[model samples]
Target: MTSPVAGAVAAPASRRPAVALLGAYAVSLVGSRLSMVALPLFVLLTTGSATRTGLVAMAETAPYALSTALAGPVTDRVGTRRVSIASDVASALVVGAIPLLHATGHLTFTALLVLCALAGTCRGPGDGAKYVMIPTVARAAGMPVERGIAFADGTSRAASVLGPLGAAALVGLVGAAGALTADAASFLVAAVVVAVGVPAAVAAIGPAELDADDPDAAGSYRARLASGARFVRRDGLLRSIVGMVSVTNLLDAAYGGVLLAVWATRQGGGAPLVGVVAATMSAGAVIGALTAAAVGHRLPRRATFGWGFFLVGAPRFVVLALDVPLPVVLVVLFVGGLGAGTLNPILGAVEVERIPEHLRARVLSLMGSLAFALIPFGGLVGGLLSDHLGVRTALLVCGAVYLVATTLPALRPEWRELDAGRRRAAEVPAPGSAPAPAGAR
Candidate 1:
């Protein structure tokens, strides 16, 4: 989960904050991705049913919407570091218990569902907090925002690359149960890293008196959350992204949460094949992230964004729908993942560019929570479709929807506002910030 910073030159002391924050974020992300493989694998291996896997996926994602909504203002109040550390501690214990309970012969479907929900609940805020801290970490490190964001995106891709492969190997060595154990340990280690690595000054929240310049600083938590929602509603680009991501995320959930597992189960290759497929996508993403890190600033926003979505979204389902050989599917996924890789860095750079630091957590949480609102339904529906219409039919339906959704932005004139907003934002200095150094490039 730790990575040497690529494409940025900064003093050692100056870089520590970004390093600590990004490394900690990557660690938790890696653990989350590991569970992405392990939890579904465990349920499928144990219950031998896609329905059960879907239910577990529902349990895992359902609380995230609620927790992230509530966690936003609290994260602003209590500080990202404390929230992250406490959440990871709780998550580690909860995930660790799944294996222990199974060993004790006391793990039931009900208990497992509850534990998965708890883990998701704990992570929701931590994820928000980590994101909110990104600008702070980057500024403290004296790195250009674009390159810093690219590094962050790349690290996440790196983690995604490692998580599935690591989970697959762990599952092979000691079993799916053991893989869950490793996931738990990763969370604990992430907590420790956050606690020890990030400086108190950088990680802690300052007094409300320090927010005299931030207009939304004095509001009630509800008002603050509402302000964030209002900002996104008013901003054409943010609104477009939220709308697009909400549907795409739902489709993605179906693919990751149920479809892949079900497809693997039916194909008779099981978890190992599932890991191999996911790893291919992740590997492509790594390449894409590195490519983005090198030349993202030079890319046109609208065309690149739309085409990236096109490459990543529709093809997987189409490939799967054809019931192609495993090698063919892997090739498709790798190509799709390459397209997927260009997305987040661009999205991250744009969103971070527009949002003020004070409202970052609240707005990010609100936008993210709303975007993910339908994910549980995606899992549930995918399971139902897999069970009822057969997996191939379900794949075609999802792919068709995905194609339509990703294509909307390119044709819509409202998206032209993205370039306008970027120009306006570039003209204004970020609050409490100075001009970037000439050497930042």
Candidate 2:
């Protein structure tokens, strides 16, 4: 649905792209975290094996990878708004199917896996669109992409905090399948936000020669794909940044999945412990979002991004695995979230800034695929490690790995390039967009 574009939307753009980007994403996460909580609970309640929950996780991740890989050109060709609206609805329908099937006694592992795959598929394309939208809006509004994306990432973290907590409550009250229905409802809500809340502002069409750098013009989709892949391979900063983020993501997924719950179980906190831990991290993440909103622009994004990995990664094990009290763990997570707040949007800005529009989706997808590819393995390995070495030991081991993965990238000269590529002096306003002078921040 197209609407008349409005004046720089800080005051009028429904959700304010920079902030709306974050808020809308936050709302989406509400659905995701709720599902994350509900799916496992449903499987556990129905089948009595915690391991069964991994199937749902697998389903979601598989499609996430596939869609991410394929969706980039779609983001560039069709524009982010259309892709976002369509994907959100598709995701809503898939999530809705879960509760529908449960009601009819048709819910089965096979069914759940299929649905999760569908959602993942939608999410990949949707995420690509969302990333494209962020820069487009920020450039239009004369705001830096970093602030907007950071705000968006932090908002996402806030939802991460709330969604699981809501899921836990809903699951406790209405049972897990019922929570799935609510999760489905959130996607519809997300669709509404993307379709209506976001301003339909397209990236400016420069002259044909100006558009010569278009990555998709390789004559065929497969060739375009190769072009994008080749571009990334040739870029030192982009490649290294992707590697660092990917490793960071892998470790985070491995350790952070049911992290607090595992620890709580060890310490004799039963079924409810998992929700509490998730909530703690969520709360930390929300606080982190606010912090990002407050300071994202002023800080050096490359450094901020690295520190974010350090904060959330290194401390996860240290704070949770220790023999400290539960309240103490909550505080640590809250502080850790502050770091989480800055990591995503900064990197998002970095990724978008360095790449041409044509390669955006492919690079983003490849990065996501590489980074998250091993999460399942991380889970499998983590689960086994937790079983034998104690959850605390597993967490500590993850923390040590986090240090190694995150540090290599942080120390690289390429990080300096990201800073140099988009300085205030050299900032290239998206073609046709008017931006404020160097003093805006």
Candidate 3:
């Protein structure tokens, strides 16, 4: 299972320093994922209101947009390892507060939202650090940049793919608060792991030419912001990638936003079946993630992304349209999940390799934010379409939109260069880079 991903290629298994740092990063990501699963489940059980569920989801999401937007620059200014550790420690405190508040019997829903929002703020920086740190670790380990990215992506998939069910099991055994306690514990573990492990890989001196400490590094905060803007704007490869992925995000959000409820209702399966659907999707994605790791680094990143999107996108329509039993649905969903699983890690590796270390966090955050920016819109659209347009019709519309979005980048000549990113060094920066600094580019 030793795939050729662009990561710590220093010594196969002999690179102890690199391995330690990567291990710490992986642990931190997994710990964060575990908390992500526990938080929502805890909320649902305490108050079985879908409205509240949606609201909580929104609270978490709003902060993600805001935090994700800024995390990149902050990560660039401070060391990613330090930020990762600090955020995890902060996250631990926030998640731990939930149980503490509940224990003291003052855990109002509004208070819960505020706490979740605070924790939500940490997610962006923490996420940005991982992206920013990967290449540094890969370079330290002498691993291929692609392999480094693949390893990171693979670990994230493995950690997150299993988080929710584990949360549910904990809830069943010790109640939601207990699950929250464990979530808090995971954060602490992650913080400790990063502190002890990641420094070796990340402690290297970065290029001062890109240093935020240089008052002349850029200009105003707005100018610094624009640097990333211009990079993304002018980079044909980045533009194509972001456009296609953004579309996929929108369509997936549409279906995911409403699929469980709609499918259960259509299939005459109850609310519990929603859990079954989610589990099936997760299982499928886990399988896909593993498969992607097997083939991702060996193949061209662009090809992997395109084929994977095809796999992830095409079957979704056919599967959702079926009236088969839950078992059958699960099987097809797993197959579909395989494609879905391939997306994040492969592209994540590509972006890391293409961008500079100092700008790594900002570029990754901007790209992720754009790709996922439409989730809320998709969710709302799905809900509305299902209510007024029928589930099957909604599914059809989503599928069409997905296809259109994923393929849109292929239409332009400059974007065609994206397929050649592995061979091409040139990029057209995003207009947003102008906000970073006047002379940034």
Query: Each candidate: how many clashes?
Result: 0, 4, 43
For each candidate in turn, the TM-score is 0.83, 0.85, 0.84
Candidates, ranked, TM-score: 2, 3, 1
What lDDT tens digits, residue by residue, belong to model 3 across residues 61-126?
A: 888777888777676666677788888788889878999999999999999999888888877677
What does candidate 2's lDDT look like per residue over 1-441, in tens digits?
A: 122442233344433644555455767778888888798888888878766777777778888987887776656556667778788789889988987888889988788878888899998888767766776666655566776776667666666767877987998899888998888887777778766667665332232522487735645777766776787889988788767767766677666565555777778986677667666777777667667666676777667777777778787678777778888877777677778777776777777777766567667767766666776676667777788887888888888888888887778777787577568434654444356566964
Which candidate wins on lDDT?
A: 1
- Model 2 CA deviation exceeding 4 Å by range: 1-23, 45-52, 106-109, 172-174, 203-212, 270-277, 319-330, 387-393, 424-426, 430-441
Q: How high is the CA lDDT of each candidate model?
A: 0.81, 0.72, 0.70
Model 2, position 147: C-alpha lDDT score: 65
lDDT of 2 at 259: 57
lDDT (Cα) of model 1: 0.81
